[model samples]
Target: MVDFFYSNQLRYRISRHLLYWLSFNLFLAFIWGSTGESYQIHLTVQALLWPARIFVVYGTLYVLIPKFFLKRNLFVFGISYIIWLLLVTIFVQRTVWQYSRSFFFPDWKNYDMFNVTEIMGNVFDLNLAAVFPLVFVFVKFYNAEQKKYLTLEREQYKSELNQLRNQIHPHFLFNTLNNLYSLILKKSDEAEDALIRLSGLMRYMLYEANVPKVPLSKEIEYLRNYIDLEKLRLNASNTIHFTSSMNKDQEIAPFILMPFVENAFKHGISNDKVSTIEISIIANKDLLTMTVYNTKKINANQDNGEKTGVGLVNVQKRLELLYKDNYEMIRNETESHYKMELTLNLI
Candidate 1:
């Protein structure tokens, strides 16, 4: 639909320009012919003047404007434009008019070819023909500048997004390796299984998650694997529940939902007390909603300086860069619990 609309607009602009030039030529012929005995002769004379007019207009548009006017060399631009105008007026327009008039209307009075007043008048009239196309020059320049600006902005956005995504890899691997270290120290029977799960997670991070977006199902699988790993480090007192419901496969920004779950497991679990972390995801055709809620351990040392984990901060930044106004996040924290709710418009 958008392409169709722009295509129609381009056609309209082309037709309008063609119509304008046709009308302008006819108008010039009618005005000039009114003073002549034969309108047909005057029309032919006007037709002969078209090449000079085209030269003046297009030279100003494609040459002078780009070379000097747009370069902020106004003094040079002014001087060059004046010289160009005079050269075309003298060598093309005036010569064409003189010879064509003498050929068609042999009895008509002829003026001195180099009369300053006569040449100036001719210059003024020729300039009038060049007026309308100047609007096109300025419009083209404005569009070019706007396109350049948008391209730069998009490149900067991608650079920042990639930097944020890279930050997640180290933060995630560091936490997982710490868990593995504890299991190895205890000589736990689950160490080998944990190593296998870590390998799978690393594979996903290294290979699959490098793209701008991934299938929602793949992201969910990653989250489940991370949750299973965290579960291995927990005792009977720590409870974690994760639920997801998706009607269809959809693509989403990679690892966008991982930080909240990581934050919950990091800050909400304790061996000495009962703690709970609840994570839920619901995705439909138009929207994806995720909620993560965790109860803070009572005796755990709380570092109030950084309420949100490092991974969470990077995720929030990524959300702003990727989704802009299409996503909403709500964060609520109290003495007992912390909750994060995110809603994304998938369409």
Candidate 2:
């Protein structure tokens, strides 16, 4: 209903204005006729007076308000308004009312042209008629300002999201390249296969993942490829467990889950000690849940804001921006392991 009134369509504007004027005229007729006067005569008089009332209302709304009042030219606006009110009251409203009364009651004495009381009454009536329509003018100004603010906010969000995503791209690539270089230095045959998988990952990042959302199946495939790349560099002491279940098709913000899995692999593995990394994903209807757990060397400073790299922090910010109240995340640490669990609503 609010949208209907504020709509910019010509037909809607015409209908809304017509309805307001009709209601205003009927109200005036009712008020005047209640004092034992003929209702039809009062209605006709109000109808004849519409031309002057419309001129006063529209001139104030479109010209006086915009040109002087909104510009803060208070002295000019006051002078112009008073002049407009007197002219309309004397030349237009008084002439219309006296002629209308004369037509209705030929026996009644006509009001004098310069009578002070009659001029003041016409001025009051004109101001009263303009009051309700003036409310609409302010309403339109407020709506325009609100729309402009929201547009700026949306643009800022897009720019920040893009910056965060760009930061992740180079960070992930640097880590993967380091792994690939290590394999090549060892004369490992796995280097060739890792390069191929890396090419596919880069393709997805550059193209498919650039959008706001991607199919859950495609994201899962990307994760699998990433895990395979990491597996090439893993030793016998490292153990990884990955599991997933999905009952229906879904779309999710791209790369939202990758940082957790990447963090697990980067910090979990140990050369001399047994290392274990576990990952799980489950999707049902509009909900998705993920868990990543990895064993890491215990340190006293881990809980004291020690640097844990950029991936986790970047992902946390992205989650807040994209999902806000629709997602929940929990982190836990113990003597030997770090775990993160995320629950997201796809809808």
Candidate 3:
């Protein structure tokens, strides 16, 4: 009952009433056909009879089939027809019996006067005439609504995923350029090496990163190149210590782990502080875990109010949508350090 109301079964109710009224009017016409005299009197009788007929027929349908019975289509149709048959039997018998009792109950000879089959045929004719058209209309409308809704939802999801993917490209390019600028300032011979690495990174971003997924080994190689470039920039100051370990034989979504590493190197290391950044990745047949930790300056600049960097915040949103309950991300910060650990259950 609650589901019916919440589903707003107004159309169903209207169909039921329409079917019942049509059936009742046909039955009333059939009854009146057997009597020709006093047409006005018979029409008045039909007007009164229709209300009771509708109440009994549609009321039984509403209660038994929708509210009480199993609600299967075959069961509802079969039982409703059986109920209508019984009601018609009683109506025909009472009408004939009343007429006989009035005149010659004791002397009646021919008892098989009325045709029962014709009456039952008329009842079925009325029911099918109303049911078929309404069933067609309802099914057509329902299917169209379902298709439109699914199409809209699919387009919305595609748009959102595209926006998120666009964000990754610019963020990555910005960080790589920053690292290149740092190398040029010190006139290091490794600046040539940095350019070579940057070209490889650009090739990967243009070709491989556009794919939905890439081998874990390829992504790890990308990260290693990025780390080496950063290393060349910090060689003069010697303030950044970076360590990395990974699985060389597994696969993962491309670029999934880069933002955390980028954030650590961006916020954790400085020109004046001796800082350490450690990254580790372990992958098995069913799971992958990546952890990154970086040391913070004792008197780090505190004016910026951003907790996780913008790149990491974007990564978090993507993780929530893509992995849902299949992943866990933990981020913690204290007066001395910042840490992030992400675990993904891969299919």
Candidate 4:
């Protein structure tokens, strides 16, 4: 009784109610059509033989359908169901025959009505009545299975998304911590400010990014904070620029754009020569477009071993799961520069 209150259990019980009542009532009606012109007698007969009807109907639906037919043993399944039908018919007919003989057909010996031929004649109709609701039962099971499958798929997607989201945090922290270390080593005055920016970045990632979506305005602010931090690492010889225009009300996946910006800084910085990084974001109506380009340093192609930005790989997977075919991305890399352009159709 307590277990039935569980959600899945409750749903299963509710789902079976229709099959149970409909099969019972329909089988009772089929029995009613074959009786003689005595209402009380027929009612008594119905009450008595219902157990046998239940045995055959439920047996065929549960036992035969699953154990035999659904398992691809059709030859044995057909024979088994036919045998069950015949046995139930024989049992009911014998009981009715005995009762009617004792009361209405007393001393009318050697009656033709109780013979095997008469019993065999009704097999087709009995099987037809029994098989009628099998269609509904199969359909209900199919629908239930489909619902279960979809639920599992949704859960799996959420799990994968959470994992990909988790992957972004450590990669981000590693880069920021390295920057902080360099600032401290050089005894740069910007070290304290960089630490403060790192604090803000951590706060946003910890709280805001835990959700599936965040306001596009907040994301851009976060991006700007990161760019400001990176700018601190540059000297007079380097240039970094960011420009964005979007309504504050629009929402987007958290940290979705951070990887491109981070990659631009990672590969485009140098003390040997002047370098520049360009970043742009434009969102209007339901469309979002972003472009990032950075001039690669001479010998910047260090086998950093981390060729694929974990964040970029993570975002691409997330886009596939969240947007499917609704998003487009372009990449152009030349000997001197690399550019990434992303377009998204927002909901």
Q: Write the per-residue lDDT of candidate 1 for residues 184-225, one digit (tens) a residue.
A: 999999999999999999999989988888999999999999
What TM-score does each of the candidates earn?
A: 0.72, 0.75, 0.59, 0.73
Mind giving the per-residue lDDT tens digits that candidate 2 earns over 226-266? 98888888889999999988998799989889989988887
Clashes in model 1: which pairs?
A: none
Instruction: In candidate 3, list every pair of residues with a backbone clash.
Output: 216-251
The lowest-lDDT stretch of 10 consecutive residues in candidate 4 is 1-10
Query: Which candidate number maximizes TM-score?
Result: 2
Residue by residue across 1-347, what tens digits does model 4's lDDT show? 43342234757667565656676667666767766566666566556655666677778977888899777688998899889998888876777565666675565577665576867755654555466567656665677678899999999999999998888878778878888888999999999999989998999999877898999998999999988877776789889889999864688989888888888888887777888899999998889999999998887666334654577888899999999998999999887898999999889
* Model 4 residue 25 CA deviation in Å: 7.2
lDDT of 3 by residue, 1-347 (tens): 53332233777657655765676568667877877756666565455344435544555445544543434465665676567656654564456444644453444444443557745553564344335433543464466568889898778766765677677778778878887887788787778888999999999978987776777778888988988877765634344444444544665666778888888777777668667777887776668888888877555556234743666777777777667798998888887788888888866
Best by lDDT: 2
All models: lDDT? 0.83, 0.84, 0.67, 0.80
Screening candidate 4 with a backbone cut-off below 3 angstroms (N, C-alpha, C), the clashing residue pairs are none
Please give the ranking of all candidate structures by lDDT, highest first, separated by commas.
2, 1, 4, 3
Candidate 3, lDDT over the whole model: 0.67
Q: What shift in Å separates residue 44 of candidate 4 from its native position after superposition?
A: 13
lDDT of 2 at 277: 93
Query: Which ranges of candidate 1 are over 4 A from the true structure?
Result: 1-27, 30-59, 72-124, 297-309
